[model samples]
Each structure stands twice: as structure tokens, then as C-alpha cells.
Target: MLSFRMLAPALIALALCGTGPASAQSFTDTQRGDIEVIVRNYLIAHPEVLEEAMNELSKRQAAAEAAKHEAAITQNADTIFNSPRGVTLGNKDGDVTFVEFFDYNCGYCKRAMTDMLDLMKSDPKLKVVLKEFPVLSQGSIEAAQVAVAARMQDASGKKYLDFHQKLLGGRGQADKARALAAAKDAGFDMARIEKDMASPEAKATIEENFKLAESMGMNGTPSYVIGKQVVVGAIGLDGLKEKISAARCGKATC
Candidate 1:
């Protein structure tokens, strides 16, 4: 009486060693039926094995992806953290840098904005960079163009942040019109903003952001890079704080 777990490998080996098609193979129909029975009974008796195998597979995949992201992060360090195209939010000379690639129309990005703000307020020495990644719609692209133009109008990026908060926090869709309205409310030189929105520099900056995102394997909004980790989605305040703390020191809590 072989246990189901012990029979799994034998079943696999038998399948592999089969010489021909399903209609004409090494094992007889009776033998194949027995093998199937063993597998089916074993799975019915112990479903935990399936869950364990799936968990192991997930772990292996995550490890491989992490390794790949680490390599990409190293390869794109300059464009990721030090690019002039990115808008700075916190201390310029902070010891740790947190970078966010976001779309204005992305709901998750809007929610994650609060976490970013809270982190910046609590950590005076943390550097925050915002990369405009407008991938949602044409409206998103238009909003991003306005954002880039606003950043160009004032190199400090002070006005850009204000415009960002207003539009992302505002109701309804965030298109070129809404973004321009936010820009005006943020006290940007409206005339200059409109003028620079069409400038090649603005277009080039956005194109560079898209290229960087593509190289880093970022296909969605609100993706993040903190320390040596590439975090996707809105991981919340605690998650971000832990990564930032880990970057500053060696542990999740510093």
C-alpha cells in the first residue's frame, strides 16, 4: 500500500517514460487508470499538498522577481533617484530617497499620496521623488504634461506638488483642464505654464520617464523604489515606513 505522496513521483516517471501516443503507450489502460486513481485519491485525502506546492512555487517566483528587480534598480539608479526630471518632495539632501512613479488618474496613486505626505511629515530627513507616469488614458497623459510644465516653470517643484495634490484630491476625472485649473490655483504663472506645456523640454522629460518605467519593468501606476526594494502598488504608511527605516539602518524598525 504505497502512500499517495510516495506514488506521485512514480506516476510522473511512468508518464515520462511512456514510448508513444495516448492510444499506444508503454502502460496499459488499466495501469494508467490505477495511476490516475492513486493521484486522485491522494489529492482527495491530502489537499494540503497542493497548497504547499503552490506556496513553494509562489516563493520561488517572488525570489526570482526580486533578484531581477534588484538588477534593474542598480542599472537605472541615476534615472531612478537622481534624475532632474523627477519632482522632489522632501529634504533635498536626505540620507534615504523614496521614489514614486504615478499617474494622476490612477485611483491607487491618489490614495497613496496620503501615505507619501504622512511619511514626509514624519521623516524630516527623507527624500521623496515623484515621477509622472501617465499610462491610464489620454487625459492622464494630458495631466502629466501640465505637471511637467508646472515643474519647469519653477525648478523648485513647489508649485508642482501643490498642483498634484489639488488635482489628485479633486473630484471627477483628472484631465488637462482639471490639471490646468489646479495649476492656476497653485499660483503658477498660467501664461508660462500653457506656453511651456507644448515645449520640447516638457515632452522630452515625460518620454524619459516612460523609458525609465519601461526599463524598470513598471507597467502600472503608483510603483515605488525605496532603498534597494522595488515595491508596486499602495503599500500604505507602515509598509513605506518600514522600507524607509530598513534603508536607513538594517532592520525594518530603526
Candidate 2:
């Protein structure tokens, strides 16, 4: 492990050179060495400056990423919130839309399902959309295909939600077999599911979800787009509520 004494000179030099190659080129070897020594000594004596600089860097990076998310959200607003490729639940005409991209086999999504359900029950004005993002496994792809087929046979989303909860909340690996079982239990037409799962719409729906997720720079299950912001992980129910409230009425609670 390099100590601060070992790293200070390089850090200071990098900071100075970060401005431009011209400024670094203007300095002679001796002058640059002298500058590094001075800055290194000052930084060592006031170590808090390093922490402050790093905090500032973090803030700037977060702001840049948020700006990127906002840009993507604006560009894809119509498809993201209202595309028929996704399953829409909750208040259809709600002011706030909570969109989730999830793989059936994801553990975090299994846990997050409760949050989605709770929100639907508690907040009548929040629109929730579920998109199949089957990136975890081949089994996940198979399960998603069945799910898409289920949705095709049930436009009301009632049976689809039941199938979703059963397969996602189940204790085992989610594959075509388990998904079919869930659909059967949810009272879906198995023959229709088997036939529909092979349809172009099933493939197209999953393809559309992957495209949407890629556009938003989403790479994991349970990623969300609430209002203008992209939330990249399962932030728990309370954390999710804050994001929802921020979108709903410009506050953490509304």
C-alpha cells in the first residue's frame, strides 16, 4: 500500500496537468519538480483538502450522470411511460409514472415486488409499468417469454400480475416450466400460452425492453425511471417512496 507521502507528488502533478498539456509543457523539469514539492508539502500538511477535493469530484460526477439520465428520459418519454410493450398497472391516468425493468430471476426484484404491490394498493394516483428485462440467465429469457405470452392473453393485467407475483415470489429458479405453472395457477390458457410464447410479439416485446433499458444505461434488474430521474438499483421501499414523492409533488412526501 502506497502511503500519502508516496502518492502526493503524482496526485499534485496530475491535478496540474489536468488543465492542459500546454501548461505542463510550459514548465521546465526543474520548475515542475519544485511545484510538485510545494503542492505535495501543502497537501500533506492539510490532508483535509484531499477529502474536500474528492467530495467535489463525486458531486460533479453525480450531476453529470443525472444530466445524462434526464436527457435520455426526455428523448424516450413517449415509449418509456406509455409504450404498449410494457404492462401498465395502478392508476392509468396517474400524474406520476413509475417504470421498472426487471428479470424474473433477480433476487432484488423478487424483494422489490412487494414495494410495487404496496404502492399500487396505497397510492391510487401512481402509474406503475413493468417491463421484462431478462438479462440474468437463459432461464430468465424463457420465463420472460412465457410472461409476455401471458400478458398477450390477458390485457386486463390482472392475471398477468398474479402470474408475476407467483413466479417472482416463488422459491426456486424461474424457467419456462415454472412460468407455465404460474400461468396455469393464475388460470391462463396453457395452450394459448404455449402458442403465443412462440409468436413474434413475445420476441418483439423482450427486444423492445432491452432497447429501452440500454437507452437509459440500465444494466441491472429493478432499475427504475421515476419522473425525470433514473434510479439504478433497488433502493428499498422508503427510498422508492421518496423518489415517487419527489416526482409526484416536488418533495420527499406528498
Candidate 3:
């Protein structure tokens, strides 16, 4: 916020004054007046720069504060999700639960899928709750509808996770047609899946997910609520493992 450009004149003035310490008795009235005039003119000419510098400083401070708040939010994920929609994975009676809010078109979500799969495979005491919070694009919404329909046909837990990973891991956009195709590839009956996707129950589930996401203040895809922590983005497998360990110990790692 302290503008180096605006400080150039002051620096030059200081350099010209030499390394000697200023003595009250050494300066003439005229010299004092000249210095004051220079400073006053410089400030007056750059009045707008002062405001700009202050605003920039304030923004940096605010961003730092927000980052701190986000870290704390990650540490306190217990109060984040009381109830969530979509299929769940891991032990039916696992000790720790990792809840995720994801969109089908989210690249980060796709990246996180590998970590989730690894966790499930390596840890038997871990549980995962997948919440469909498709807020990216219309294609994402259609994908969510198809995912909900898959859940209706008993495609919960691993199957749903599998389908989600497949759609996001690929290069194509996930629209209704593409989602249906993916559902079939994941072993779901395409016609039944499409019909179920349009049901009132599925619509209600998606609506609930939207409301929950809004209430939780989640703005983007691939946000997670693990134990008492909320992690946004794919923070990698080690990060997730640390959080899971903390959760097991009745604490949370941000």
C-alpha cells in the first residue's frame, strides 16, 4: 500500500540530506519552508494515490482474514452438515465420515476422486457421504439429475462414486444424454434411470442439496465437510488422511 513511486521524491530528498543526523539548530527557516512546500505539493498532487494505497492495503488485510476464517471453518466441520443427500460409502458403521459437496463438471472434484477411492480402499473404518451440489453449469445440473436417478435404482455408495469419477475423469461435458450414457456404462438401465431422474423425489433431493449448500455458505464445487472441518478444493490424499486421523481423535485438522 505504501507506493514506491510516490515515495521516490521523499527518498531523493533524504539521500541529498547526507548521512548526518538532523540537528534542530542546523536548518535555516527558508530550508524548512522549502522542504515543507515540497512535501505538501507532492501529497496534494497525489491525493488520489493515498486512497488507492489504503484501499489496496485494506483488501490484502481482508484476504488474509478470510483465509484464517476458512482454516477455522475447516477445523469445525461437525456443525457443517447435520443431514446430506446422495449415496454414502465406506463402513455402514464407520467411525469417521467424510462428507463431500461436488459438481459433476468440477475438475477439482474429478481430481479428488482418486484420493477418495484410495481412502476407501485402504481404510475400512472410514465413511464417505456424497452430496450433489451442482452449481457449475446446466450440464452439471443434468448430471446431478442422472446421479440422483441412479441412486433411486439402488446405485448408492461405490456405484455412485464410480459413476461420478467416470463422468468427471473424461474429457466430455456431462449433459443429460451423456449422463444417461454414463449411467448405463456403470450398469444402470438407461430408460429406468431417465424416468426416475424426472421423478418428484429426485427433484426434491436436488433442491435440498441447493438449500444446504447455500446455508453452509459453499460457493464452489469440491467443498468437503470432514468431521468438524470443511475443506475446499482437492487438498490431496495426505491432507485428507490427516483430517481423518484428527477426526478419529475427536479433533480436526484444517
Candidate 4:
């Protein structure tokens, strides 16, 4: 448990050296030691400077990370937003597109599914894309394969959404067997779904999803893309609405 007071000296040392002590050739050991003492004394006298320095450092780091995310989004825009592999929901020809990368075994994703559905129901002009990001377990991967296979059997994706709701909203771990049962409940032909599950198309779609997720630095489920902004976590329905509004009208809400 390092406190701000304890960390101030190290931060000050970095500020003076402009790099780690090992890489710093400009200052001698004696000079560096003297500078550290001076910085420590000064910071002790004026603690606000330490706070200001920390704030600036945080701002710069956030700006750099945001730039990286924006660049990644630009590079993968086509595959991310318009890929045929992604499951399409809501208005197919909507003005604003929202994308979600989710795992069936994710508890947060199950809770967030309602937010997605509610958004679809409330906003007719919003396009929703569901990416199968099954990093939780083998069962998650199996469920995603079946979901993608269900998508293939019926291109309309009507049954796919139903199957999604059934499995994600169901109790306990969602495995291949449970996923197949959901598909059956959604009126999908079990024989065809089983065959399609083992097809290369299903494998390819999941592979592409993993690739896209990796490219975008997504390491978890329930992450979202609303226009150019990459939003992580469930973030609730209000948070989603604000992002959607921001995308459409340049404001948090219309």
C-alpha cells in the first residue's frame, strides 16, 4: 500500500531524469541524489504540485490511449461494423450502428442483453451488431459456434436473436447441448444446426471475431462500439443511450 506521499519522491525522480535511472546518462549518481532530495523537500513544502503533476500525467496517458483506440477502430472499421459474419439486429438500415462483443458465459453480458434489446425496441434507427467473443470457457466457445451456425441456417437472424436470449437468459452454464436446445426452442432445425455447427463457416466467423477483438484490444465480454467510441462493460441503459445520442446528434442525448 504505497501512499501518494511515498510515491511523490519517485515521481519527482522520474520527472528530473526524464527516464528511468538506468537509462539516464545525462546525470551523475551524485547529481541525481541531490536533485531527488531537492524535489522531495520542495514537494513536502508544496504538495499541490505533486497532485497537479499526477493529474497532467493521467491526462496525457488517457489521450495517448484514446488515440490508439481511435486508430485501431479506423483500421478495422469495415470488418467491425459491416461484416457479414456479425449478427445483425434492430433496423438493418439504421443511421447509427452499435456493436457488442459478448460471451454467453459472462454474467455481465446476460444482464446487459436486456439493455441491447431495450435499445432495439426504443430506437428504430439504431443498428445492432453482436460479435461472438467467447473467452470465458470451452462451453462459451461451443455456445458461440452454435449461435453462429444458427445464423447461417437462417440468414434473416430472427431465430438467432431468439436463441441468443434463450441461452444467455437461461440458468447455469451454457454448453453446446444447452445451446442446441435453445436453437430448437427458437424453431431452428436441430439436424441442420448440428451440421452447420461443425461447418467451416461457423469456425471462420468465430475466428474473425477473435481477430477483431484482439486488434481492438478487447480482452473481455460486453464491450461496445458506438460510432468511433469504444465503450467497455455493461455501462447500463442510460450510458448506452447517451453514446447512441452522441453518435447521431453530437450530444449525449437528443
Candidate 5:
């Protein structure tokens, strides 16, 4: 016969195996066989509690990583917009600064251009910084060159913004010929604009914009850095307005 102590462990295992309820428990030979099979199958299927624990732990780790990314963006308010290549529009000494990274070929950027113009017109104390991030195609680079060349013609911020709007707003690609034609339509000197497009300063400025965009993790064409938030994609006019308003109170540089 099994000792009482040894039988106690077997009885407890049998109870866990559903041989009978712990309270007033009893088992027949058939019940004992079924209980043994149940226990064996369970042990085989769920052999490692450690694996389940690890899976739960991995889920927690991924959540923590996402939170950390959000926090990092929140803390980057000053560094993103205050960089050297950042442009200022509206009020040079405005209470709010909205920085946008855009490509000449991005349709969403063209759509947002109208909103930007409207906002500038509405708010004199709003400063807008435009960063040319030409990531779309080879044609985008040509468009950026012409736009930067137009800026070199001593045009006002309004002209730059207008040209930006038109170039992005148009159909077809913005190749060199198309960009120069757009410049002419914007009242820029076609001959001088083409010559100046190849200047070292223009190249340097575009390179700087590229570097800044890369630093801020701006892989896409239409990304905005408002206050401490790095908003990716074309979130429309209202979304931009809200971000700018929030930036005014929290952190203006970024």
C-alpha cells in the first residue's frame, strides 16, 4: 500500500485532474483512468508556463517601446523647428511658428498649401517655416531647385508660398521644364531663374533641408513638426491649426 504522505500527493493530483471535487471527493477505477489521461494530456499540451510568461512579457515590452517613442517626440519640440535651415513666414517675431516639410510633387502638400495661405492671412502673429523635402522622385528635385531659385530672386514670402502652391497643385510631373514654366507664370525671370538654379547656395540650401528632414525622421513628403509633436502625413488644415495653437502655449521652437 502507498504511504499516507505519498498518497496525499497522488490524491491532490487526482483532484486537479477532476477525478472528483475536493469537497467529499471519491473516484472509481474508470474515473481514475480518465483523470490520469486528462492530467497527462494537459501536461503535454501546456508543458511550459515560462513560455506563456515570456509572451506576456514581450507584449508589455512592445507597449513600453511605443510609449517611449511618443515621449521622445514630445520632448523634441525645440530641436526640430529651430534648426538653421528652418524658414520663417507670417510674423518674423510671431508667437507661433509652424514648420512644414514638403515635396513639390506631393498632392496632399498642394492641398495643404491653401490652408497655409489662409492661416497666414488670418493670423499675422503666425510664423510659418517651409522645409523642402523632395523625396518623391527625380522630378521633385528639379522642382525644388526652381522653387529655391525663385526664392533667390528677392521675392516676398507670399510669392514663395504661391509658387509652392501652384507647383504642387498642378497635374503631371514637375520636371525641369515644367518647373521653369511655373516660375515664369509666377512672374519670375525665366533666364536668370534657370541660371541661378545651379548655384552652390541653392544646392547647399536643399542639402541642408534634406539633412534636417533626415534628423527629424521625416521620411515622407508632408510631415509637420508642431511644438513637441512630430505629425506625419497630411492631417488637413484644422489639424494643423490645432497643432499650431497648442505649440503656441507649450513649445514654439519645434
Candidate 6:
């Protein structure tokens, strides 16, 4: 009676016959059917084998995804880390650059906003870049356009960050009107923002963000590019710090 674990290797080895119709010639139909029957019965008796196999598969997939992200980060390092299109904050000359793509209308981005602020507050050596990635709706695009316009007048990112907090943290839908309200409260020159909003810069900035995000496989708000790692979603503050540590010292904690 062969155990599930014992049959696992055989199942994995049988994968060789799946390359193509020509390559599958190595295993005759009868032989393949016998192996499949044995493996299927074992898997039924011990379902943990399926779990173990899936876990291994997931590990491989994650590793492959991370490698792809690293490659994309390397290829676009200059634009991703140093492009003037993105609003730079925190230590500009820090050891690690953290780039975030967010849509103002996203609820997760609102919550993740606190985590970003906390990271900047806690880590003096962390540099932050904010890019507008408005994939949510027409209203989101409108808000992002306003945000990019606000970034134009505020080179220091003080007013822009304040404006960002207000738009993302505020209640209800984030359209041009709501964004305009937030910009006013942030004390931006309203006339200047309106003028900039209709300029090519605002449109180009958002377009560039979309291109960069698409290249890196980022399709959501609050996706982060920290130290060559493309982290999707808000993994919380501790997860962020660990990524920073890994980037800084080549480990999750340093």
C-alpha cells in the first residue's frame, strides 16, 4: 500500500509527459492511467497530499512573480524612483525609496494612508513617492487629475500631501468638486490648481503613472514598489517595515 507522500513524487515525475503530444509518447495510455489511478486513490485517502502539493505550487508561483517584479523595477529604476512626475516626500536622499500608486476614491487607500504616514514618521531613512493611478472610475480620474495639478504648485509636497490626506480621508465619492474642496482647505491657490488641472502636465503625469504601473503588473490602488519588491495591497505597517528592512540590509529584519 503506497502512501500519498510516496505517490507524490511519481505524480510530479509524470508531469514530463505533458509537454506536448509528441513528448507524451514516453508514457503509454495504459501506464499513465495506472499511475493516475494509484495517485488518485492515495490522494482520496490522504487529502493532505493535495494541500502539500498546492502549497509547493503557490511557493513557486510567488517566487516567479517576485522575480518578475524585481526585473521590472530594475528596468524602470530611474523613472520609478526618481521621476519628477511623482510627488516625493520623507527623506529625499534616504537609503530606500518607497513608491506608491493609489486612487483617491479607494477605501483601502484611505486606511493605508495612515500606514504610509506612520512609516514616514518612524523611519527617517525612508523616501516616499506618490503617483496617481486612477483606475476606479470617472470620478477617480477627476480627483487624480486635480491631485496632479495640486502637486504642480506644491513642490515641497507639504500642501500636496495635505491635499492628498483630505481627498483620500474624506467621506463620499471623490470627484473633481470634492477634490477641489480638499485643495482649497489645503490652502492651494485655487486659480492655479484650476489652470494646472487643464494643462498637459496633469494628463501626462497620470498617463506616465499608468504606463509604469502596467509594466509592473500593478492593477490596484495602494500597490507599493518598495526596494525592488512590488507589494500589492495594504499589508499593514509591520509588513511595510519588514520590506524596508529587507531592502536596507538584505533581510526581513536587520
Candidate that would win on lDDT: 2
TM-score of each: 0.84, 0.92, 0.67, 0.89, 0.66, 0.87
Candidate numbers sorted by lDDT from highest down: 2, 6, 4, 1, 3, 5
Q: Which parts of model 6 are misplaced by more than 4 Å?
A: 1-32, 41-48
Hey, what RMSD does candidate 5 come out at? 12.2
- Report the C-alpha lDDT of model 5 over 61-166, residue by residue, as the tens digit: 9777546545655555455555544555788778867778888888888888888888899878887788778899999999888888877775356666667666
Candidate 3 lDDT, 1-254, residue by residue in tens: 45545665664466347645556346677876676677667767878856885788799997775576456555444433334345778875788888788888888888888888899999898878788888989999999999998887774456766677778787877888888877877888788887888899888888877765665567887887666555667889998899898879855442
Residue 93's C-alpha lDDT in candidate 5? 78
lDDT string, candidate 6, 1-254, tens digits: 44656765568466555577576667787877777777678679988877887789899999999999999999999999999999999999999998999998889999999999999999999999999999999999999989999999989999999999989999999999999999999999999999999899999998899999999999898999999899989888999999999999999888
**Candidate 1 on 28-128: residue-level lDDT in tens?**
76877787787778778988877787688799999999898889889989888998888987999999999999999899998999999999899999999
TM-score of candidate 4 against the unseen true structure: 0.89
Q: What are the RMSDs of all candidates, in order?
A: 4.8, 2.5, 9.1, 3.3, 12.2, 4.2
If candidate 2 were superposed on the true structure by all CA atoms, what would the RMSD be?
2.5
Q: Name model 2 segments beyond 4 Å from true.
A: 1-24
Candidate numbers, best TM-score first, in rank order: 2, 4, 6, 1, 3, 5
Clashing pairs in 5: none
Worst 10 residues of 3 by lDDT: 75-84
Cα distance off (Å), candidate 2, residue 118: 0.7
Q: Give the number of the best model, judged by TM-score.
A: 2
lDDT of 4 by residue, 55-105 (tens): 898999988877887898899999999999998988999999999999999
Better-scoring candidate (lDDT), 1 or 6: 6
- Superior candidate under TM-score, 2 versus 3: 2
Ranked by lDDT, the better of candidates 4 and 6 is: 6
Report the alpha-carbon TM-score of model 5 versus the true structure.
0.66
